[model samples]
Target: MEPVSPDRVSDAPDDRFDQSVEALIFASDVPLRDEDVARAIGEVTGADTTLEDIVAAVERLNAAYRATGRAFRVEQWGGGYRLATIPEQAGVVRALFEQEAEKRLSRSLLETLAVIAYKQPVTKPEIEHVRGVGADYALRQLMERGFVDVVGRADAIGRPLLYGTTDRFLDQFGLGDLSDLPTPREVEEILADPRFSRERAQLLAEWAADNQPPPPPADSSEPVGTRLRVVVSSDSPPTPSEADDADG
Candidate 1:
C-alpha cells in the first residue's frame, strides 16, 4: 500500500481545535486570552483542551501567516491572543470610521490631562493648586472624554478622589509611560511665553463657556464686571541710561 499521506493523518480532532481557535480569535473585539481560546475550543469540540495546546496551534498559525505574507496575523494584546489586520492596513480602516467618532480634547482639557498624567493618583485639589484655578470643569471634561480616570482615593483626610490617566491616554498621547513628561523647568519655559499663556487662557475660557454652568446675571446682588486687581510685582528696574536720560 502507498505510504499514508500527511494531509490525511493531519485531519484529526486537534486540527479541528486549531480551526476553532482561529474562528474565536477572528471574532474577538480585543485580544483574547489563552484561557479564552482554550475555553472556546472546549465549548465547541466537547473535549477538554489546554491553553498550552491552543498556544502552540496559534503560534503555528501566526508563523504560517507571517511566512505567507498574509494581510492579517495573530497578535497578543491585553493578555489575550487575537487575529488582527496588519498595522499597515489600520489607516484604511480608520478612514472608514466617522470622523465625529474620534475624540478630541480641548486645550484646557489637554493641559488638565497632562497635569493628571504627570501627577497621577493626584487629587482635584492638587490639580487646582497647579492651575491656580478651580479645575472642576476641566476634570468633568476629561472624564467625559475618557482620558482621565478615578484610580482611587487619597490617604489624607476626607479621602478625596484621586485621578490618573488611562490606557486610552497612553494610546492617544503616543507615550509608553508617564516618565516621558518634561521636567518642571521645561514645562515652565513652555508656559512662560506671553502668546502661549494668552492662547491658553482663551482656550480655557472657551472650554468653560461651552461646558460649565452659565454665569450669574449682572443684576445679582454681588457686583459684576468689577474684579479687584492687585499688583503682584513690579517690572525690572528701569535701565540706568534710560533713567539718567529722563532726569536730564
Candidate 2:
C-alpha cells in the first residue's frame, strides 16, 4: 500500500494538530503563513503537516471562535493568518486601545515621520531640512518603535543612510501600501485652506503663550505692576498718558 501524503491528512474533530495550529496562530505577534505553521507543527509532532492541513486547522479554529462568540477571529492579511477583532467588537476594542493611543508619537515625531514617509528613500539631513529642525531624536524614536528603518546608503559625498517606512508603519496606519498614503497635493490644499490654517495658527499661538516662561520674575528693584506696564507697552501702541509719561 502507498503511504498517505501529508496533504491528504484530515484535521477533523479537533485533533492535536488542529489545537497546535490554533495555539501558534494565537501566540504569534505577526501573521503566520501556512507554510510556517506547517513546518513548526511538523517539527513538534514529528508528523508531516502540510499547508492544506494548516489551512484546515485555521478554518476550524475560526469556526470555533464564531460558535463560542469570541471577540476575535483569525483572518488572512499580508499573506498570513492574524487574529483580528471582529467588526461587531471593534467599538470595545477601540475603546480598550484608546488608552494606548494616548502614548502614541507626539506631534514632532509625527511631523518627522510624515516627511520621511513622503520623501523616502530620504536621508536624515533631508528630513531635517524640510522640517527646519533636527530630526535625530524623532528618527531614533521612530526606529525604536519599528515604524522606520534604514533601507540603504545614499550615493552622496558623505553617503548618508537612506530611511524608509516599514511594514509596521503601514499596518499601524491601516494602509495596504505606501500608495495609500495621502498625496502631497491633498496635504497642501488642507494647509492652504484659510479656515484650517487660521485655526492651526491660533491653537499654536495659544499653546506657545501658555508655555511661555512666567514673565521673568519681576526684577527685585521693579514693582510687578510696572513690569506689566512695560510688557503691555511693548505689545501695543502706548496710550497718550503712557506716551506722555514716557516722554516726561
Candidate 3:
C-alpha cells in the first residue's frame, strides 16, 4: 500500500507557494512585469490573484533574501522584476570562474561611442557629421558589443535608423548617465597625453595657445592645465594620423 499523504486540499500547495514563485522569478531572463506575476498566480490557483498580493509576496521574498545574505536578489530591470546578483559582487563572480576583465575599448570605438552618447538619438549620418568620417564600422562594432542599440528611425529624407547607448554602455563606462561624460575640453586634455608622443602634445599645446587668452599678471594667475576648446569644421575630417595619435 502507498504511504499516507498530507491532505490534498491544504498542505501541498501552501508548502510549494514560495518555491514556485522563486522558480518563476529565477527562470525569467527579463524582469517579470507585475501583471505577468498575477497571471502566473491565477494559473496555479485556478482563481484570479490581485496585483497587490503578488507585489506583497515579492516584497516578502526580497526582505527574506536580504536578511539571508544570498548571492543573488530580485531586482527591477528592463521594466520588470528579476533575480540578479548585487553589482558589488561582480569581482567575486568573475573570479569564481577565473576570468580577467577585458581590455578597455579601442580609441576609435571610444571616440565613436562618445559621439553617439552626446548626439543620440542620432543617425549614422549625423554621427559622421560630427566625427567627420564614415561611422559604419564603429557603429557595427558598438552594436556587436551591446554598447549601442537601434533606438528609432530618423525623420530625415531616407529615414535612417537612430542609435543610442544601452544600459550596459553606462555600466561599462562607469557613468551614472550620459550627462556624466567629460566635456570637450576634458576630452581634449585626455587626448593630449604625453604618451601620445611629443609631436601630438605640441600640436595640442599650439592649438591651446592659439585659442586661449594670455596668462594674467602674477597677482591673477589662470588655473593650471585649463585649455580653451577650438571648434573644428564639421565638413573636414581629422587626419588619420592625428586621429590615431589622439586615440593613443
Candidate 4:
C-alpha cells in the first residue's frame, strides 16, 4: 500500500485512541499485529478492544499524520503494523543504509528465497530441480538470516525436510502475507507493460524462459545432481579447485 500523502488527507480530530496506538507502534521493536495492539490497549484501559477498532484507530492516526505533514506513517506489513518513512524521506534514509549495501543477499540467494516463498513446504531437491543448481549454501544463508525455516518434512518418499518462509521474510520484503506476493501472471503483466524498457524486459524474459532444468540423459527420474551440471556462482558452494586454493 502507498503511504498517505500530506495533501490528500484533511485534518482529523486529535484523540486519545490515536495517541495510544501511535505510541505503541512507534515504541515497538517489531511490527505489532492488530490483536497485539488491541490487547495492549485493552490492558491499559480495562476495556474490550476489537480488531476493527484497532484498524480504524491506525487509519485515523495516519490521517492525522498526513494532515500534519509528518515524514513517516504507520504501515501495515507482515500481517502487522510498523512505522515507515514516507518516500519523500527516502534520500536521507537511504544514505543511512548505503554503507551496508555490500552485505546484501546475492542474486542466487534471492532466487532460492523466491522459490521457497512461492512454493513453501517444498524440499531441497524440489528447489534444486527448479533452479538447476545446489541450494544447500543458499538455504543455510537464508536460515542464518532468519528468513527461512524448516517447517516440517515432505510426506513423500524418505520424508525429506520441507522448507518454508518465516515472518522475517514477509517483513524484509514489506509484504503483509504470502497472498501479497506477485503471481506469475502479475510478472508477465509487468514484463508486458508499455512503460517497461525493451532491453531489460528481454533479459528477464530470456532468463525466465531459459531457467528450465535440462532433460535427463536417461529417465526423468534420474537424480537431480546427475541430470544437471553444478554451478559455482558468487553465492553457490565453492568448487574443489577453489576450496583447495582457499586451504593453501
Candidate 5:
C-alpha cells in the first residue's frame, strides 16, 4: 500500500472542500467546531483536513454568500460554527415567528430563567430566594424545555443542585454567548416597558415581602389592657409624673 503524500492532500480542490464544509454546516442543528468540521471532511474524503483548511473553506463560503446577498450566513458562535440568519433579515424573521413567540414562556418562567441565566451555577433555593417564590415548577418547566440544566452541585449545605443555562438557551434567544446577554441599561429599559412593568412590580413586591422582618411576637406575658394602653400614643406630651410612673 502506498502512503498518502502531503502533496496529494493539498491537491484536493478548494471548491470541493468548501462544498463539503457547507454541507456539514447546513446539516448540523448545533454549532460545528473547526476541528469537528475538519474531522468530518477527512472521514468522508479520506484526506488529512486541517483546522486551517476548514477555516479557509468557511471563509470562502461566507464570502460567496455575501457576494450573492444571501439571507443567511455561517457564523462562529459559542466556540463553534453555525448557520444563522443575517442581522438585516432579523425584522422579517421575527415577524414570521411572531405568532409562535406569543406561545412562549410566561412571565413567571421568564423571570425564573433570567435569574438562572444571570446567576448561573446557582441552586434552586437561591433562585427561589431571588424570585421570592417556589421555583420547583418553573425549574422543571425550563428543564423540560431544554433551556436550563443541572450543571452540578453547590458547595453549601446539602450540596444542592446547581443549575445553568444550556446551549439550547443561547440558540433559542439568538445569543452567541452569555456575554451577549442584555446589559444593565438594556435590562432596565426592558423592565421599564409598559408590558413588563407589572411583572417587574410583582417581582419587586414579592422580594420585598420575603425580605421584610416578621412582626414582633405578641407580648403574651403582659396584661392585655396594659399592653393596649401602652401601644396607643397620645398627642399630648406625657407629664413628668406620667413619665415617672411609666418608667417605674
Candidate 6:
C-alpha cells in the first residue's frame, strides 16, 4: 500500500480497493494471483497496490465472512488464492457435484500417481522401475485429467520426457504446493491401515463379481429371485405281488 496524498485520504479508496479485490477473486474461475490483482487494481485506481495490500484486503474479507457466517472464504492454494467452501459445507458441495464412476482411479493409477508425486521430474522408465509396470496408460490418464504435465526431458540415453504434478493437481487435492505431499514414510503408515487393505479386498470382490460369467439362463419362465424345485422319480422295480397285479 502506498501513502495516500492529502486530497484522497478518505475511507472510500480503501473500501473500494477491498471491494475490487473481492470482485476479482469472485470472478476468476481459477485461483487468482495476488500480483494480477495488484496490477489490475493499480491500473484502475492509479494506486500502487502491493502484494501485501492484496493479502491484507483478503484477510479483511475473510474476517468479514467469518463474522457473517458465510459458507465459503478465500483460501491460498497452488500458489494463488481461490474461494473455497468451509470444511463443514464439504458434504453438501460433494453431493452437488458427485464424482462419476468412470473418473475413479484404479489401484494402478493410484500407485503411479503416488510415485510421480513423490519423485516428480522423473521419467517413464523410472516410474515403471518403481511400480514394476508400464506407465503409458497411467501417464496418459493423468495428463488427460490435468493432474500431471511434462516438466522437462531427462538427460538419459533417449532424453525421455520428465513428468511432474501440475498446479491443477495441487488445487484439486487441496495442497498448497509439492511440499504438502506426504513423505514416503507417511504413505507407508497410511498403507499399513487395516481399512486400506479391507477396501482393497472390496475392490477385488467387485472386480470378481463384474468379470464372473452370468449364470446359465433358466428355460422355465420363473420370475427373477424365485427358488427352483427339483423332483426325482424312482427307477427300481416292484415286488412279485405288484408284478402279478400288473399281469392280472
By lDDT, the better pick of 4 and 6 is: 4
- Superposition TM-score, candidate 6 onto the true structure: 0.65
Candidate 1 lDDT tens digits, 68-179: 7888877664356656678788777677874545455678777777789878889999999988889999999888777788999999999999999876565445444466
Scored by TM-score, the top model is 4
RMSD (Cα, Å) for all candidates, in order, is 12.2, 11.1, 14.3, 14.2, 13.5, 15.4
Which model is ahead, 2 or 5, in terms of lDDT? 5
Using all chains and alpha carbons, the TM-scores for the candidates as numbered come to 0.49, 0.53, 0.51, 0.69, 0.58, 0.65
Report, for every candidate in turn, its global Cα lDDT versus the true structure.
Answer: 0.71, 0.77, 0.73, 0.81, 0.79, 0.80
Q: Lowest summed lDDT over 10 consecutive residues: which window, candidate 3? A: 1-10
> Clashing residue pairs, candidate 4?
none
Q: Kindly report which residue stretches of model 3 are placed more than 4 angstroms away from their true locations once superposed.
A: 1-19, 50-52, 102-121, 129-134, 164-248
Which residue runs of candidate 2 sit more than 4 Å off their true CA positions?
1-24, 34-69, 75-80, 86-101, 180-188, 191-248
Give the C-alpha miss distance for residue 150 in model 3, angstroms.
Answer: 3.6
lDDT of candidate 6 over 135-205, digit per residue (tens): 99999999999989999998889889999999998888778788888656677778999888778667656
Number of clashing pairs per prediction, in order: 1, 0, 0, 0, 0, 0
Best by the lDDT measure: 4
**What's the ranking of the predictions by TM-score, best on top?**
4, 6, 5, 2, 3, 1
Q: In model 1, where do residues sit more than 4 Å from their true spots? A: 1-15, 44-55, 98-120, 127-138, 164-248
Candidate 3 residue-wise lDDT, 1-248, digit = tens: 12223354435553356565677888887567777876887787776667665665566567667667777776655446678787789888878978788467888898899888888898888888887888999999999999999999988888999999987776556554676676666766766766555665567667766776666678875554444545322235677898999779
Tens digit of per-residue lDDT, candidate 5, span 1-248: 12223343444687677778999999988878777887887788789988777777777777778767888888877557899998888778889878555456799999999999999989998999998999999999999999999999988988899999998888777777899888656877776788785665576566655555455468755443432243232435677898899779
RMSD of 1: 12.2
Residue 207 lDDT (model 6): 60
